[model samples]
Target: MKKMKALIVAAAALSLSALLLAGCGGAPANDKKAEDKAPAKEEKTTLVVGLDNAYPPYGFIGDDGNLTGFDIDLATEVAERNGWDLELEAIDWDAKDALLNQGTINCIWNGFTMEGREGKYAFSKPYMHNEQVVVVKADSGIDSLEGLAGKNVMTQVDSAALDVLEDEEGQKALADTFAGGAAQTIGDYNNAFMQLESGTVDAVACDLSIADYQMAAKPDMFVKLEPLSTENYAVGFAKDGDQAMVDAVNKTLKEMYDDGTIAELCEKWGEYGITIDNWVLVD
Candidate 1:
């Protein structure tokens, strides 16, 4: 009787141990199966685009007090097509290099000139052609670049027009004949126009597109002289930054051009000289 009781106890202990081990082993498999059935959370990419908000037809504050322009619209579309979250960062035009270097912004997209800055930034393919021109009041009688000589001319600081005026071999000879022997620099075009209106400056040197917008906004107020230099407009990325992003932008621009999205935008901003004729997408 003692042996039978002992054997029965041993059998019960072995069965309990087997059942516990089986339960422990099965729990992990069930947990793993449940884990496998769960959907993975997708990560999204955010593209931060830096631009001069005051630059009209490209990026600017409309009467609605919101950022809206050609580049803004183009960047928004690019972000949407790439499944990226878009962030438009308004930055000081002169401090663009620092912002790009610090990664505060991804790229400079507001009417950025790529002709003279090819070595400084990783530029996307040129999307449009631009010209640096001088603007004077209609009655100022500055019908040609020659008339700008010996005048108090002004241009935006760090702008392509200024660059042309500063280039010793370029339009610097013409700029040297100005009132101060050089073109005066300002922070923005609006201020330059204000100074021109107040007769503080004789003429304003700027991009033709900007001049066109200003002329249309205030008819019979300004006249654009001959072009100082012709250049191309492109997105400026940090030279050492993401080339992948530049390539992506280039691809998107090409796609936009093919699908007539760019043309539509040009039509919308036609008053600023942003037309399909200006678009020069090579490859």
Candidate 2:
């Protein structure tokens, strides 16, 4: 009877050891199951950006039916890295503000200016600094801004440059300095350049990077006279506390700047990148 009791106790101890091992082993499986479902809760939303499809070097469509440009390409790469879908909406420049306000688009991811529109819209930290360069023919006698008097200068309709010319004091200054020459506003910046090309306008005032890109693409056709005013280019997000989108975009923009993506794009387009000190980066 004693021997039988000892064997029974030994079997019970073995069974208890098996039960303890089973519980410990099952704990790992439960932890792994919890991990498997964690990713499901981490899904994120894609971003949609609005831009003008005809703006070259910044954002535009290619002959291959692809939407490609400095901004478009950079934004797309950022979105892809973050597992976000990017919807590039081609909208009229005049409708840009309306679209953003109505949520028709999330943000204007283009070469938006921050100077004249100060405190007007919410802006991301400036991505690239630029200056407006004056364009003229190589043979034109116009070597500096001082010589623009009585000349027909061109700019884009509703552009900040036009504002610079129209502000009462600014307009008076322009008139007195340039012999009261008029600065006409065309439908697009390209039109202003074209007017210069066709000899219809004396000069074209445009972003230096853009003028460089245009001249490089069609060499021997343009001559950037001189830089007008330096400005910072940034993306426009919602004006309110839409900090989420701002954080995401500014994060990607900084990444691009650090990784030489922005510089590469400038070099690829053969335009000299502007220095940051000349313009401010609004966060």
Tens digits of lDDT, candidate 2, 86-132: 89999888888888888888888777767778576788887777776
Candidate 1 positional error at 202, Å:
0.9
- The Cα local distance difference test for each model comes to 0.90, 0.72
- Per lDDT, the best of the predicted structures is 1
- In candidate 1, what are the lDDT values of residues 153-244, reduced to their tens digit? 99999999999999987899999899989999998888999999899999999998889888988878888888999999999989998888
* Model 2: per-residue Cα lDDT at residue 160: 58
- Model 1 scores a C-alpha lDDT of 0.90
Clashes of 2: 1
Candidate 2 at 63: error in angstroms? 2.2
